[model samples]
Target: MFRDRGPAWRQANAGHVSLGQLKVTSAIESCRRASLGGHVERSEDCVHTQIAYNACRNRHCPKCQGAAAKQWLAEREADLLPVLYFHVVFTLPAGIADIAYQNKAVIYDLVFKASAETLTTIAADPKHLGARIGITSVLHSWGSALTQHPHVHMIVPGGGISPDGTRWVSCRPGFFLPVRVLSRLYRRLLLEKLIATHKAGRPYVFGNQTPLADAQAFAAHLAPLRNAEWVVYAKRPFGGPEAVLAYLSRYTHRVAIANSRLIALDQHGVTFRWKDYRVEGRGRQKIMILATGEFIRRFLIHVLPKGFNRIRHYGLLARGACAGNIARARELLAIKKREDAPTETIADADKPRCPCCGGRMILIELFVRGETPRHSPAAPTRAIRIDTS
Candidate 1:
């Protein structure tokens, strides 16, 4: 689909596509191809040979996420607490999504900051949980249909550490925090920071949002959101820490759309499956067809800025401090830490078995990109020898 549609999209959106988006497109086009270099493997019996191309490993490439997601989940599994985990979602209202699209890095960072402050502050209240909570937040910029709908999905422990750090404070069963309270605080904090950013001349505004370049215009745009009830939804608690890992496996490294979702590609357009949340029940699983340019445009809009982080940890789970905090929490709660399991290296696990004989395939040669494969009886001077055993 990219090969067929990418050129037209590039032509139509020239000068508008970001360097990050262009890099993503280029990487996707070259992913798992010999142009990026690869190795040749021969079966134990030397009767079968296979060429394995290196992956581009670009974060946005749908083909490269499986291994990355697995590795990430493996590391995260060790951090889980033997406690209930709640799934909370904080979403931006449509009024703000326009400005968010223009200032993705700034707005998304504020989303994380505001949401984290709301959760930790409320949980720290004496009338509430009165403890410090940990949060794992993942930002998603697209809805199911690939439209720009910015939101943060959070995996939060159902409880927190007491203010004095002496005890494990658990929230009431089946409850975390009041949604209305969280909504109000998040709205206030986000607006305050956004206005401050604009005043500092740091927030980006473009295209139809050029009016927001004026401070008064920007303030007027955010006026309605000040009184509006922002959306802060908390789903039922995860079954357990194990269930949280399963959920993260699906969401953590997800792209706007997976290759498996593409149903068809032709000169007319691309057809893909998408869920319509507004539709009720089974009817929501619907199909959408878009012209090639339109589809690419929608997908590329979600390409985040370079070096911007979409996943963040907060409070107790803050990276530098999580280890000590988690250890202390587990001890206070009388929860036993699971011993590390012996496991094969990722390469050993991912090594492909011979398709012809179901035997092991060993790397036999490494080829630099753009170099022609040698065909002579004698191996090339540059070929590195490997043990077949």
Candidate 2:
């Protein structure tokens, strides 16, 4: 179906090299083997790409992210809370940078487990406005610059249904968990676990470094983060239930950026835009051009280890009785059934909000042929507007 993935993607994998390309090839092979039954034959000439069997499109695959986004939103419809949802991000420090790369499977798991565990345990404490909260944690391994910045972005319901599952307890506006406290606890959890791994000799293979060979060096490397505050950046909550669903859409099965984000891929390498967080507000919106090789390097850094679950549901949202509990929550909220469940598809963009402004959002324009966005007179605007012009 994707005969041409734009010039940059094609050139990045021009030699059929890079981990992303290889993973894509593997996805195609797997899709062919795992039959989705078959599509109905048409009397009219088939317009859609009919290359072969379709991808199961698990979230982790670069190729499968599109399909996975659809399936994820459909299932997430059940978990939506009547109250607002917070966007909380927990990032790992570079103290364990090399280790996370080599042991992505294990370390990424620790990131998710620790971040979720911290949010739940803290929220459950009476001192911290005690209540059990449900969480959807997604692991992101790259920064906008394409560096290995492994972190977990959690979409947590602002308030959890009370322990008795009668009513929801909402958090104050602009306040989720305190980031400073969350950072301290998260740092401790990861360090303690990393130490245990080193002690067990299972995951730590500190190759050919006398300094790292000794536990003191390892302890010192981790010492900074002990007092050093790891970051827990909490974004403002989405406006309401629909906004929360839209928030999850951007992350569901996303790569560093979509293939379409890539602008060009001639011998000059690659040219694309990226956000620069060092600046505030609109200043952060900037375009970065990189060598083709560098683009490959950055994208590859985000490639998760095999079988790693980037998105995880925990607490009341966890599998087993948790699924039923969410349904009960739905009942309490006076919400009805998911009538569109059987026919749901991800392609419906649903005017998901602009990440910059927590205002009403709709696709203003759509692109074709890898072209830059052209402002047409017929373009759609938001229910509310923040003058970008």
lDDT of each: 0.89, 0.69
For model 2, the stretches where C-alpha displacement exceeds 4 angstroms are 1-21, 24-63, 164-167, 207-210, 331-389
Query: Residue 12 error for model 1, in Å?
Result: 3.5
Please state the error at residue 101 of candidate 1 in Å: 1.2
- Tens digit per residue, CA lDDT, model 1, 186-251: 999999998999999968787888888999999999998888888999999999988999999889
TM-score against native, each model: 0.93, 0.74
Clash pairs, candidate 2, are: none
lDDT of 1: 0.89
lDDT of 2 by residue, 85-152 (tens): 88999888887777787678888887888888889988887677577788888888888877888888
Error of 1 at 225 (Å): 0.8
Best-fitting candidate, measured by lDDT?
1
